[model samples]
Target: MTWADSLRTAWAGMWSSKLRALLTMLGVIIGVAAVITLVAIGNGASQAVASRIETLGTNVLFVTPGPGTPFTTRQVAYIRDNTPVARVVVPLLNSGGQLSVGTSTLPAPVVGTTPGYQALGAIHLAAGRFLAPADITFNRDAVVLGANVSQALFGAGNPVGAHVSLLGQRFTVVGVLQPVGQGPGVSQDNSVFIPLPVAQFLLSTQNLSAVLVGASSPTAASQAQDLLTNLYTNRFGSASSVTVASEDQVLATLSATRATFTNLLAGTALISLVVGGIGIMNIMLVSVTERTREIGVRRAVGAVPEDVVLQFLLEAMVMSLTGGALGVGVGLVLVHLAPLILKTPAVFTPSAVVLAFVFSTLVGLVFGMYPAVKASHLHPIDALRHSG
Candidate 1:
């Protein structure tokens, strides 16, 4: 028989037992859908992390002290003076606090940094200005509102000159920052920025949370990181006393970690496809038994064993491919809705979809082979004489 004729026969056979065919395809459907959805979520999370790191800029270095080894302004100044490649060295202090404007209240992260903090990148203003040198020097009670904080406190009104209470202390709003969205560490959109000294006074601590360093160039960033690492290590008497990482190093580490997790999830999901293939094999074996008499009649009518094998194989592939198509639809729908439900990014990857579909087709082909060969090997006379 021609390939078209074999395919027609396969379709007829599956159509005669529609419910059974659908039941046989169920595993492939679930497997493909699961693989696509899980991979998409994993890829999305990786992309989100990468983007956040990229926003920190390649020319920047993040220096975070170990627990109980917080750096003071004097130490920060020494690093600034010593590291010639570093263009900007800004000390940062972070704390969680309640912000209130009139009766409206919301919990937000408060950042304390120098005016040089603005030079690091991802700092943009939608309305007024960022922290000024005078503000830090004078320890002004001035604050800058992040996009979400401004919205929560002032609604549609201008927040530049408004007065707000932060941790029960009244402060004047100096600026409103444009929305920077979520990132690796603290979310810029949900934070409030104040003078470093003011934060030190409010938190009643001379310690800093972190230090941000901007190098003159990407090539210089590595040198700056090494310089800072040595400085901290010598001061604290251990290499682990502080963590100094360039943005590229951080991105590479995060990418490797994310890739490992994504691969693990994909591998786990692939087991479902294998299980589904086994189910197909089981059902096909049963089909071969039930269709023994038909196979005998066909062989008696000049149909070759190869034709029988081809027909059965085609039927298995058709079922799996149909299930894969349906799975693609379901997976795409889930990818679109997942971000809303999970509150994280989920990107649809075409490569993942294609891979899943191809794998499912392969499953059908491989699992259906033995059943087809078994069906074809039956002696014609014996098959014809055998009772159902």
Candidate 2:
């Protein structure tokens, strides 16, 4: 028989047993859908994590006093729009500072930070808060509590007038900062924010240890790096004093994390596909037995062995392929809709769609092959002798 004739006969057989075809296809569909949905969701989550990190601050960079470099609050100025790019520098002063309300004493991350830290840390005041121009102006002994700190030490107890001990000195709580999570999330609460100048004076270590610099946005973070590097090189005459890390670095780390999850998901989905393929093979084998007499008659009437085999093969392939297609649709829907159910946007990717379709076709071809080969090897005499 011509290939067209074989194709026609195969399709006719599949169409005749619509219910069986549908059942077989279901397995293929599920396998394909599983792969698509898992990968898409993984990628989406990766991107989401990156975005959240970037939202913490822009063009943010850190500096650590290098080996042999003593950290002191130096005369260097904080980098600002007005500070010549090559001339600006800030000393990093990380110290232990004490904050007390009434009799409650809480020691927190005392950063001897330049004024720019106010913007870079996204520090906001919950009450009479944030070091005002006057406070920073007068070099006042004042303090601000991170959101978590305010809740614990004050909790609407009015911390504005509260006295806090910094190191050994007494300072008044000037501002109660709205909670800003610790940088890159080291903690959620209880941080003491003092002006960089105040930190330097009290800590009695006047060499800039590290500078926290902010960029306008995540994408422009790299630009800020160049500015910082050039500034450091010009002032320190070396690159050892500063290092610039963009939000992209955190995103890359998160991507690596997602890869681990993807591997796990892929392994599970592969097992499902294998199980589904075995089921298809089993069903197709039974079909061949039931249609033995029919196969013999077709062969006797001029249908070649190849044609007989093609017919059975086509039925299995069609079922698996249909199932694969349906699975893809279901999976894509699930992945895309997940974020919505969780009150977030779904990340749709075209690559995922193509991959899903390709996987489905593979399932059909792989599971359909054995049945086709078996049907093709059948002898007309033996088939005719068999009772359906």
Candidate 3:
């Protein structure tokens, strides 16, 4: 028989038991859909984290003191004055406190930093201005509200010039920052900013939490890291006194970690495909037993063993391919809706779609082989005598 004739025969045989055919295809359908959905979610999470890292700028370096002692303003000043490669060095002191504006009260992180922090290009003001040099020098009771904090406390109205209480200390709102979203080390939208001196007095700590250093370029950032590392090592008389890392280094580590997790998730999803293939094998074996008499009649009517194998194999492939197509549709729909459900973006990858479809087709071929061979090997007289 021609390929077209064989395909027609196979199609007819599958339709003869429509419900059984559908049931056989169900496993493959679920497997493909699961693979696509899981991969999309994994890719989306990776992209989200990468974007957050990128927002911190590739030319910035983060410096933190080690376990023995915390950083001081004098050390921060020394670095700023001596490091030529560093464009801006900002000392930061972080604390958590409850903020109250009238009846509205919310708990959020409060960051204390100098005016040089603005030079990092991470902060953008929506209204008024960032902390000034005078604010830090005089320990002014002024604060800048983050986007979310502003929205929660003042709603649509202007927050600048409004007075708010932080940790029970009253302060005037000097500015409101634009929405900056979450990034590595800080959630810019959820925190408040104050002068370093004010934060030190309020929090009762003269030691710094961290220092942000901006460089002219990525090359400069590397040089600055080396310089800061040496400076801290010598000052504390130990190499382990401080930790310095460039943005690129941090991004690489985070991206690698994310990729590993994504791969693990994809591997877990692949097991479903294997299970589906086994299910196909089981059903095909049963099909060969039930169609033994039919196979005998076909072989008696000039059909060779090869023709019988081809027919059975084609039927299995058709079911799998059709199921894969339907699975792709279901996966696409779920991928689009994933953002609403997961509260994060879901990226549909073309490679994932192709991989799933191809894997399903391979499953059909591999699983169908044993059953097809069994059906073809039967003797005509014996098959005819066997009960249906």
Off by over 4 Å in 2: 54-118, 121-248, 342-345
Q: Write the per-residue lDDT of candidate 3 for residues 69-154, one digit (tens) a residue.
A: 76788868788887998898888887667899878888676888889878889879999999998998788999998899999999
| TM-score of candidate 3 against the unseen true structure | 0.63
Count of residue pairs whose backbone atoms collide, per candidate:
0, 18, 0
C-alpha TM-scores of all predictions:
0.68, 0.53, 0.63
Highest-lDDT candidate: 1
As a whole number from 0 to 100, the lDDT of residue 228 in candidate 2 is 62
Please provide, for model 1 over 232-272, each residue's C-alpha lDDT reduced to its tens digit, 9 standing for 90 to 100.
78888998788898877877787788889788877877889
- Please give the CA lDDT of all the candidate structures: 0.84, 0.65, 0.83
Please write out the lDDT profile of model 2 over residues 226-275, one tens digit for every residue.
76668667778888755445555554655678788766775577567767
Which residue pairs show collisions in model 1? none
Worst 10 residues of 2 by lDDT: 82-91
